[model samples]
Each structure stands twice: as C-alpha cells, then as structure tokens.
Target: MLVTAEGAVRIWTINLPKAGNAITGADFIAAFEAAVDAANRDTGVCAVVLTGAGKIFSAGGNVREMADRKGMFGLPAIEQRYAYVDGIQRIPRALARLEVPLIAAVNGPAIGAGCDLAMMCDIRVASERATFAESFVTLGLVPGDGGTWFLQRAIGYERAAELTFTGKTLDAATARNWGLVSRVVPHEELMPTALELAGQIAENPPRALRMAKRLLQESRTGALESTLGMAAAMQPLAHHDDEHDRRIAKWRSA
Candidate 1:
C-alpha cells in the first residue's frame, strides 16, 4: 500500500507484506514517481516525511522474482539486469529531486536499497532499533542503487568503501556517529520526533527553504564562485515573494 496523508506536513508511507516488500519493476516505480509528483505539486504541503510500515523498512528487490529472471537465458537476462539497476537507481534519485524538505523516519532495518532510500533524504531520524547496512557485497553484488553516490558524499570515499566492502551493519547510534543519519530516537519516539522536525521546517518560508536546498545540493559539486553566482540569481526570485516582505519587516523591527 502507498499511503499519502496531508496536513502542515505530508506523509508518504510504503507498506508491504511481511513476506517481502521488494520494489518489483517499472510499475512500482511509476506509482512512487506519481506520488512524489503529486506531493510536490500540492501547494498546501511544506515538507514530507517518508517511512515504511512493517518490521523491515524494505527488502530491496524481490529475491524470488530475481531468481526467476536469472533462469531465463541470453539477452533476456542482460535486459533484466539493466532494468533492475534502473529501478533501484530511480528510488533515491526521486527523493533527491523533492523540492520540499524530506525526512526519513526510519523504523527498522534498512538494508541494501532500503539503506540507499534513507540516505537520500535531506534528514534521517531513526528508531532506536533501526539498523542500516549496505549488504550488496554480501550477495556478491556491487551497490547498484544510488548507495555508491550517497555513501561517498555523506561520509567520504574511504568510509563508504569500508562499509560497502565489509557489508557491515550499523546500529542507529553508530550510523549517527558516522554522519550517515542525522538523529536516533527511541523506537516509540521516532515518528513523533521526525514529525516535529518536519513541522518546524514546514513553518519556515517555503521559497527560502527550497532555495536553500538547491544551494546546498549545488554546492556539493560546484565551485564556490559558481555557487555564489547561483545564489545571486536565486535572490531576485526570493525577494519578490510575499514571505520576503514579512522577513524584511520582521528584521527591521528586531
């Protein structure tokens, strides 16, 4: 089930059966993409919180389906492999595109692609019981999803290489220490804390928040001079908004 809720905040929850919640192929990806588009278009929504409903956040891909596809010979196998990688890559890339602040309320084990999904979010607040691992190596696979990119940027190449090569699992606290997660909370408090953080972000001027997100993302790859030029271009757009006046007046009074 893909659940979407609206308020000062928008929540998108992915609920899959206990059997396994592997994201299958293009159909599942389309549905999630549509959900994201709808949420972004919603003028009433200021921020979004994503979480999974179950003991595990997501199992990554359907193992049974993978086994079935692997048996098919020749070009079919190669096509399936590419399709699988494409499907995996889309999930995290979609999160990175969200205009509003994205909060990952991690509830449990986030393995492989699941780990990639959480890491893609702007902020990650995890349940105490939550565990994260890049288990691709364990399965004789390289990180196919955006994990390779996210891990390296979030913690640097050395740490990302270490984690991926060993396929080591980190508890919430250790993940936080490694800068993989923003915060860790008691299991029962995870959702509430994440919502609170989302709510606070929601209260900020929307345009400014969006620009800030863009600037930060741009700064990651762009030179300082280029970032400054980008910010200069963005300032005019922000100044014309109603929120700008309110901020200027508030600052003047202060």
Candidate 2:
C-alpha cells in the first residue's frame, strides 16, 4: 500500500517488497508526490503518517539495481540509473513540502534511505523494535537526499558526522537519546500512539496548523528577520478565523 487513510491521517507505506520492501526507482517518488497531493487536497486530512507495511520499514534502494552491470558500462545507462536514483532521493524534499504535519510511525528497522525518510518527518514515534542507521557509507556512498541536512539539524553536526562516517546502528533508545525520534513506545502501541497523536493534531484548526508547518519548514532556510515577519504576518490571518473565535469564546466562558 503506497498510501492508506485512517481518520484524519493519510498513511504512506513503502511497497516495494520485491527488494525486501526497498524503494528502488522513480516510481516510488511519483507515488509519494501523488499521495501528498491527495492528502493535501482532502479537507478531512490534517496530517500524514509514513510507515512501512509488513515487517521492514525499507532497505533503501535495491542493491541489485544499483549494482547493475549494464548501467555501469555505458554513459546512457549511467544517466538513466542516475535519474532513477535522483527521483528516489527527492522523496524527502517532496515530503517536506506537504502542508500538514508528518509523523513517522517507525515500526521496525529503518536503514539508509528508510532512516532518512523517517528523519524528514516533523515528528517520529518509534516502536520498541525500531532501529535506525546511516548505512550509506558502508555501501560506499555518501548520505544522499536531505539526509545530511536533516540529520545534522536533528542530532547536531558532530553526531551526524559520526553516524555517517561510522555507519553505526542505533537502537530506539539511542535514537531517542540523540533526538532522532521524538518518542519511543512499545511495538504494540506504536500505531495507536501515532494515530492518537495525529488525531490530536487533526482536532486543531487545519489552516492554522498548516501555516505553522509552513513557517517551521521555511524557517530552516529562511532568514531570521523574514521568519519573524512571516510569523507576525500570519497571526492576524489565523487569529481572526471562525475556529479561533469559537475556541476563544469557549475558553472565555470557562
């Protein structure tokens, strides 16, 4: 299932089980962008949750695909291969632009691109069995996509470097300690907890929530003054909405 919906959260499950549920080619990116667009267009959807169906979260790219002799031998084949890799890598940035909040429900192992995908989300709730690693270097590749950017921001530059350089595996507890995942719950409780969290977010005013997400995302590359201006500019628009008025009236009456 590339995308599934439950209540207010649209779940995107990585579906390439042929390679141990790995995301291989351009099709994965196309599917993801479509899912984000669908979720964004739905008035009922207030958030998105990304997870892996079945057992493994994802095993990054298909190792066999990357090691194809045809692709390595010719310029055209190499270019085609690169295009495919590029599309796969762009999934994180496409996900980053989604209007609503994204929560990663890390049910199991997330290595390489799988790990990067989880980190790209605004929040991550991991199962006890979940594990993360930056195993790209072990495969003789650097962290592609937004992994370096997100990881550095997530766990600081030094730690990100260590993880990238050493290709070390991090368990749920260690990941939580380094601020990779926001919370860790028992395996059975993972989906419920993530859904509950998504439901809570859904209860908020949708426009305001999306605007807040935009501001936070923009803040990453936005200038400080511009961010401040944006926040200041957005307040009146959000505060004057009917949802705000009703919620405030309820609070005032209380």
Give candidate 1 misplaced runs (Cα > 4 Å): 70-77, 252-254
Q: What would the per-residue lDDT of candidate 2 be over residues 152-235, giving only the tens digit for each residue? A: 888899999999999999999999999999999999999889999999999998889989999999898899999999999999
lDDT, candidates in the order shown: 0.79, 0.83
TM-score to true structure, per model? 0.91, 0.92
| Decoy 2 TM-score against native | 0.92
Worst 10 residues of 1 by lDDT: 66-75
Question: In model 2, how many backbone clashes occur?
Answer: 0
Among these predictions, the greatest lDDT belongs to 2
In model 1, how large is the Cα lDDT of residue 78?
75
Q: Number of the top candidate by TM-score?
A: 2
